[model samples]
Target: MNGVIAGISYRSLLGRRRIWLLVVLPLVLIGLAVLLRAVGNGSEATTVTLMEKFALGTMLPLLGLIAGTGVIAPEIDDGTIVHLLAKPISRPVIARTKFLVAASMLALFAAVPTFVAAYLLVNLESDIAYGFALGAGVGGVAYAAVFMLLGILTRHAVTIGIAYALIWEGVVGNFVPGARRFSIQQWAQTVADQVSSSPFLSTEITIGFAATALLLVTVGAVLWAGRRLRSFSLTGDE
Candidate 1:
């Protein structure tokens, strides 16, 4: 990946106050972890539940949406994307570079906070932290790629992304057992379940299946986004 393209992507994401917007979710997660632990009101079950529900589930997806869409959508909206696309760099490289930047931001804002929250909540069970940290890391990358593709495909990326995350992943996963197979949260929980030896932690999807699905989705979305970028039409073709 070109460092210049990566740098541009990073600045475009972080230079705006929008990056700070992502901080709210992680900070809330951490604050809840601390408050629960400090108040002596949290049990292992509560810790795991909070981490799975709020930290891993909510924060990871939210950060991914912001970083993923933030990197590319504004550029496309403001017509700055043509400037980048007009350069000598391959579209795939540009897409990959932006993916890396969004993934990195997710790691910092989403995954790291997940680790810290787990530590505060379930410090005795180190594997819980490790599991969710790895889970969040992988899940964040997947979410970034997916949301980035959505940005390329639609003007209302954030709205659609949130609906998918909360409605499809959260609600449907709870009600429809079959839907769990396709939910990113389940795939993430599968990764978490593998790393965490806790019997209480369970995933509907097998680790192998979830890992494979994640790989296919992340790689496929970025490649497709690259293709879209290659033939991107600002006049109306998007």
Candidate 2:
């Protein structure tokens, strides 16, 4: 993708009021981490549980929803997509550019804070801080791709993404043992298990399976988004 499109995507991502929506969680997470540090509670078990529940379970998915759709949906809704579609660049490039911007923003907003929070809480084990950070980054990329595809496939991308992430993955997947097999949080947790020394951290799938699934889902979603964008209809709506 060209620099112009990438720049446009970046501005579209962080410039709007929607960017504020993305900011709240990271602020909360960092604030909570600070409070935990102030309280002198550095239990590794608590760190594992908190990171799993908040960073992976909640913030990552929500950030995914905002970042993924923020780059594309507003254009589609307001009819600006037509102009971009008429440009010389290929649809795949546009889609890839948007995905990269969204993924990068998600990493900045969610993943980096996760690592800093881990450090604040004195997580000095096997670089579990870095491990969870990497997992957060991976989840951001995967979720951004998937939700951007959903943005193209459905107008209610944010609603459906939230439902899948919060209700399905957060609630149902937690209660329904088999559902965890397909959850992104579970996959990320598997990656976290690799570089972390927290025994309490566990995942339903093996690291190999989780990594492969994460890769397939990310790549497949990006390809699907590009294909959809290639044939995206403007019609009289423009």
Candidate 3:
């Protein structure tokens, strides 16, 4: 929550070419929504499917990886983290600051766009749009925390993140019934189920389980990232 550190981290995150990925993904979601609406396929069922398969399933995790890693990974890779580490600031503070920046970026690029796209597809009269938006926002924060820790723990954070998002979340989580229980996407869908009255928004995970899992994952990842940052060397060795 250090303003100076958060500001620097925000600028650093937005400066990266990965920001374009952030921008483009949401645009694609919205564009698809527009196309669906134009084609008269913007039913509640369709909206739920699009939100579940594309917004929550795909775009959320990808943006989380970019923002989470972009906040600090580039600096660590280029040896510029030494400048931050040399300051009087504690390692946890730096981790917290960068995490805050990443979360805010997720809120903007992921959550807001999700709401807008859902609204375009199904309007705001029902809870579908709001439910999915809230779920996305919560899920984005959790993803940011997890991926930020990954960035601290490994230089190949992006590679690991892509594998997790695509292989684990997109493929396994979708098709494998047992594996869906462990997915961030499904947890978020449980949140959406609790909010939306739409039967199409149901998940095998209950709201209580989803909320608890999200809380534990986000807090645990941030704390672990802080612990890892404490031992990080100036040479970028952990």
- Candidate 3's residue-wise lDDT over 31-148, tens digit each? 9999999999999999999999899999999999999998888888889998888888999999988888999999999999999999998887469999999999999999999999
Worst lDDT window (10 residues) for model 1?
Answer: 229-238
Which 10-residue window of candidate 2 scores lowest in summed lDDT?
229-238
Residue-wise lDDT of candidate 2 within 159-226, one digit each (tens)? Answer: 99989998997998778888887888888888988878777777677889888989999999999999
State TM-scores per candidate: 0.96, 0.96, 0.97
Residue pairs clashing, model 1: none
Q: Global lDDT for candidate 2?
A: 0.86
Better of 1 and 3 by lDDT: 3
Q: 10, model 1: CA deviation in Å? A: 1.1
Q: What ranges in model 2 sit over 4 Å off?
A: 236-238
Q: What TM-score does model 1 achieve against the real structure?
A: 0.96
Q: Pick the candidate with the highest TM-score.
A: 3
Whole-model lDDT values for every prediction: 0.86, 0.86, 0.91
**Model 3: residues with Cα > 4 Å off, grouped in runs:** none
- Predict model 1's lDDT versus the native: 0.86
> Distance from true position, residue 225, model 2, in Å?
0.4
